[model samples]
Target: MNLKRTFGAILTILGIVGVIWGAYAFLAGGDSVGGVSMNQFSSVVPFIVGLIFFFTGISLIKGTKDTA
Candidate 1:
């Protein structure tokens, strides 16, 4: 596999992990590391990260190969 494909895979994994972690933080109500609620704006970080990862993965996967 090419470097782009490898990066795409890694990004995909990171996206999935981020989504899961975000969902957990959203569902499992409790105090965060800083004694704050996980459902706060900071909690959205995971979702955003996940989205970034997902989009990057898609872009990489869509890239073309010019070898002939």
Candidate 2:
């Protein structure tokens, strides 16, 4: 398989999970593994990561083929 495709797949999955977990933490109010309390801004980290992965995945999946 293509390297880009592989990385893209991983990022996509991470993004989805991050967004979901972040939302859950935000709503349910929980502490992270390091004991960090979830809050309005703190809980957004996952969502941010998710967005990064989602966008990166899209970019990778739609990237132009190299002819070199």
Candidate 3:
């Protein structure tokens, strides 16, 4: 198995999951837990990180060579 390709796929999946979770959280409006406001940090951080991970994984996968 190709390590790079496998890892890239994993990363891509994780990123997609993260992005979805972030969007859900944002839409759900659950930023506050105990009188403390996250100021959208809870959602924005994951969304941004997700985007980064997604693009990085995509690039890595595209850059890697697939050899049988």
Better of 1 and 3 by TM-score: 3
Clashing pairs in 3: none
Model 3: how far residue 54 lies from native, Å: 0.8
Summarize candidate 1's per-residue lDDT along 17-66 as a digit string, tens digits: 88777767766665473355676456778878998998898788778463
For model 3, residues 11-44, the per-residue Cα lDDT tens digits are 8998998787777667767665345354455778
Span of ten consecutive residues with least summed lDDT in model 1: 28-37
TM-score of 2: 0.75
Overall local distance difference test of candidate 2: 0.78
- Give lDDT for model 1: 0.76
What tens-digit string does per-residue lDDT give for candidate 2 at 1-68?
A: 58887788788888888888788778766655336568666788888989899889878877936445
Better of 2 and 3 by lDDT: 3
- Model 3 has an lDDT value of 0.79
TM-score of each: 0.74, 0.75, 0.80
User: What stretches of model 1 exceed 4 Å from their correct place?
Assistant: 32-39, 66-68
